[model samples]
Target: MENKLNDQKISSTIETEVLVVGAGNAGMMAAAAAAEKGAQVMIIEKEDSINLLRLGLAGVGTNAQKRAGMTIDKYELVEYLAAFAQHNVDEGLIYHWANNSAEAVNWVEDNILKPHGAHLRAEPDSLVTSSAYQGFSTENDPTIDDETFVSYGTWFQEKIAALGVNLSFKMALVKIIKEGNVAVAAIVKNISSGELIKINVSKGIILCTGGYSANEELLKKWNPLALKKNVYNDSPRNNGAGIVSALDIGAIKDEEPAECIFDRGLVPVGKKTEEMYVQTATYEDWLWLGSHPLLKVNLRGERFANESVPYQFTVNAASKQPGYLYAMIWDDNFDEYAKQFHTLGCARVGFPGYMANAKKLREDTQRYVDKGLVVQADSIEELAEKLQLPAENLKKTVLRNNELVKMNIDKDFGKEAYRLTPINKKPYYGCILGGRILCTSDGLRVNKKMEVLDANYEPIHNLYAAGNDSGGFFFGSYPDRVPGLAASHAQTFGRLAGQSAAK
Candidate 1:
């Protein structure tokens, strides 16, 4: 493969069998898989290091699941995921993840994690056999402390390096140079030196450049609703470089607006949701109790939707409210009520089937209290006053909610009986909540083989994409009911793309 540079000021030219953009979880896995196949691979990243957040890696029929005495029907799981996306997603891609994810996860365990004195474990109490949405199990998480999750990424980085994968940091992808329809080279900018480097690839180029959560321009164009309804809480470096570069060369992408929105963005009292943006340092700022099925009211102090639903559903309900914000009201017995709520996903800390971080949850809530993000008062009226909501409406709403709790049946909204905890306890707490943009779910369309496709649904030669940069697996909204589905999809398709590209 050859391409003309066309009088461009190129500082250096390099050649490789496979070129991978982004050194995230997906990119690292791609580089490692290609190098393991004896292909010279170069992985580049704009940031200095990989993201250390330990995302839940969900997979079915893995060694960890077998050790936990768990079994899941892959067909049922795929169907459930398809329905979850309203059948707008590609079933082929979902089935691909369901079938190959186990092997990919086991490969990680054997080659990367276990070698570093770490292993994968199922979340306690994560398996759910009977439910409308069945086959729910804890994602395979590394057996490491939540604080030291960075070690997992570091270990994998070292393993890939030992496999002869070239890793470059501070290298930003500018565009893909294509000869007719085949991607042959990529022009990248050195972040530190402002130098352009062209890398010619003979085999393939894999893009795993994450999502456009931080790119305000892209959000305005593709997913403006997310911008208007949620606070930006993702990495600033993830600005849709890979998706844009691929689109520049006529790659097909999801036309619908989709995102991984969570209902935990804390809007301080008297502040609007639109005023809050780009809260990346949000560890201590997290409101774990916000996920609880507490009595939520709009700025007008009226209960809107059933609080027992998924996180994004709450955000969607709130988006219709006055300021795209809602207030979560809880009593002193929040700890007891939270346990009964049985929230899933990252919010399920201190509970079985997730991390045992009850202590951290308490500390985070206290920090929010200290910062006045969460207002505390002795009565509902006082709490309403502090939150700047109508006191009478809040008191009436609280009284109605307490009545529903006593009846063990939600008259207005069909909240579960167990989740109908009363808010009559003294020392009430409240916080205005909004949506938090976790990641943009829409991106370049790819097939089951992870090959980037053209507008006509044909494969773009020598081009592949994984992670948030690749789509056809998500639409409508993210299926948070299935924990770690996003990360597992990234790892699974990432490895597949690397192996396919190497060949």
Candidate 2:
């Protein structure tokens, strides 16, 4: 521990057994795990307060899963994950996550969540209706108790506070100092004061600084398609400073960087915009893809994909469209259908706060329409004109969709028979949808032990990566349907990395 001050650059040095960057779920969990082992731990977070943008963890065969009668076929789970990543992820790392997720969930459940008056809720019954994975929730189960569901980040913050872990918020990692091939220290900036502090970790520095969704440069270099399609400024805190520092220290990169592609409505890029998305029964409720059976047309007014597929696939297809925009064409039966299916909200079914309130959502969307951010017309052709699309193509697309409805089969896009509702009613409605990136998946390459590896496949001594900051965990695209995969991997590996770094 050393401190040196100057007029322009006041420098200080602090030594700890474990240094965790970014106070998100991974960083917090890692810090707590290290402190539990009696290691002096320090966490530096960029935000004034921690974020819970995406909460929940994905685990298999936990006590909650067992209690809920959810049986996890280990072999099947591995196969499914492989298929999801198209066999591009690190096989050993994926297996490690699959095998240890149960214990990790239970561990946190006992130490962190339970103390905060929260319990892990594994509703395997959710799997019967959706292909999305069923993981554990640390939030209160309204079915069992009255305490509302709080995010695992909330629980982690609580536990870390109780453990007296040293945390400095608004302190951003600026650089990593390497002595020969080994990482020796880190330079962090006091965001408000513009001062720098040098931290020397005798044990290790765990990089849990999250993904690069906010960095346009990384988005362009790694995933250009996402840069064009993403509508919102999500994950603004994760600017890839950690990954850059690791790269500067000779860390390797994943072959295929991934991203969480989400279904987003039209939002102006450079304007102070109100809420542009509406929770309609058509898309927000079921699998966050929108209520099923809506006619999906590209900018040219042509059917593009199987609307019945998972929303991620839909986002992928929609991203290639002109301006990364697509029209979800539907008729007056939307309210009726949404009510029948119980997806009447504007956001994800279980997630009420991510554009949460239905009344507010409707009101905001209507405001956008009044301002011409959304288009509403009495007829399909007029609607197409307002969207600057070909009227005949739009009309033909609708007529063909109606024919499929009559036939009760989607021969073109393989849409299911039940979703073949004709768009024949008057006062047709359409919203221009844009793809959005939840987080970037390209991170420093790490092995099963959560060790950051160099280009030659050797561990960068005393350096580790976890959560969205670690690579080889995903490829191509994010699997949101695999409920809790992000959170589970973060906490599970964060725990493992913490223990490993402490040792």
Candidate 3:
């Protein structure tokens, strides 16, 4: 098929049965699945190499779950996830994930992880649930050293390459060529050479370019509230190129704006939210101790919402606070308190059977203290002074929090008793907290088959979207309670889309 490009020169043309864009978690899975189905697959990644940062995969009834004596009702999980979005999500997509996530996870284990030295381990169940949101223990993380987590990405790349998929880096998808309403080819640009190449796709084009978390303009347009407080932590390449291309070709997107924001974005003592953008700090800068349900006070030195809620809820509350920032105040016994908090998902790194690296938590906290990002004082008044808060208000808040700790009850915010650790142990520490955006949770609409849908809710022929590039699963906020739900959704639907498109 010869497609004319206005004011653009094509340096070369390649033919493939499936063209997968953005070689992240979803694109890799899609390419591998298409190759497994005996289809010629070509993957183009804008980056020089694949992203190595790994997230746990949520699954139900998987072999790992069986071995760990963990049983989850997939239907109940589907309902909980839907309710998490206030029924604004596509429950069918959530059901699709619940049904096939096990297969997808096991596929990774059998083909990519287990064959190598790595294996999947389930996250520990929550110690207690007092809130309406219930978190499941279905998150599975690869057994690898945190420093060498890149090995998992390497193994996946090797596995897919062995399946005869052509993977190229530094090639970014510019646009999808469509004839009528059917996608036929794609125009990609070589980032290093600035040369445009056309790939004729006979089967389909799978967009896995992630979401617009890093796109400030899109964030301001769709999720202005989230943008007002969040520090972008995702890859900058996620600029909605895939979604924009699909939209240009008549694909519809989710109406409600959503984001996967987490708590613990460390804001410097006097830094404003506007000064925060792409977080360039190392992992040591992450306020891991802040993930614990510390006594959070606004700049006015007043206690706010229940700090024991989900990570994003803390940020949501902070968004309404003065300057969209809050301070997490704790004592020297944060290590013990963190364990008592029993935080779920990625924040569960201190526990066993997951990423058991508690030492890093302490080290990170100390690093922040050394850098002055976190203030350390021996007294409540002194700590309040260092944090630039009203000393009397902070002292009263701490006294009240201590009383709650003594009573084993949070009368004000109804925080779970177990997570209500006292901040009166002496040598008080405080760090200003903000929101760190992981990704946008809304994008191009897709059905269970991972087919991109048009305005009339009909499939855009031969066009597929998976991962953050596609939506209809989430609205308003990310369901972190599900634990690795986003990654699992990406892997599962990416495979499904690749299989459907290859057919």
What lDDT is reached at residue 154 by model 1?
Answer: 78
Q: What local lDDT does model 2 show for residue 81? A: 73
After best superposition, candidate 2 residue 388: deviation in angstroms?
2.0
Query: Per-residue lDDT tens digits of candidate 2, residues 1-503?
Result: 12223213546778887899988767877888888888889999987987644445578778777777667677776777778888898878888988888877788778866776667666443322234323223221212242234555656677787787898898999888777777878888999988888888898899999888877788778876776665554577778988988998899878677887666545432221123322232233122324344788887889898775545577788766665667777776654443223221123333322333344345545665676656678998888877777899999999999998798777887765665677777677676666656678778899877889998999999899998889888888766556667777887888888888888
The local lDDT score (0 to 100) that residue 304 gets in candidate 3 is 89
Clash count per candidate: 1, 6, 0
Off by over 4 Å in 3: 1-3, 144-150, 279-284, 349-359
Clashes of 3: 0
In model 2, what are the clashing residue pairs, if there are any?
Answer: 58-484, 279-346, 282-290, 282-291, 283-290, 283-291
Which run of 10 residues does model 3 get worst, by summed lDDT?
142-151
TM-score of each: 0.95, 0.86, 0.95
Flag regions of model 1 displaced more than 4 Å: 1-7, 127-135, 144-151, 279-284, 351-360
What C-alpha lDDT, on a 0 to 100 scale, does residue 217 get in candidate 1? 84
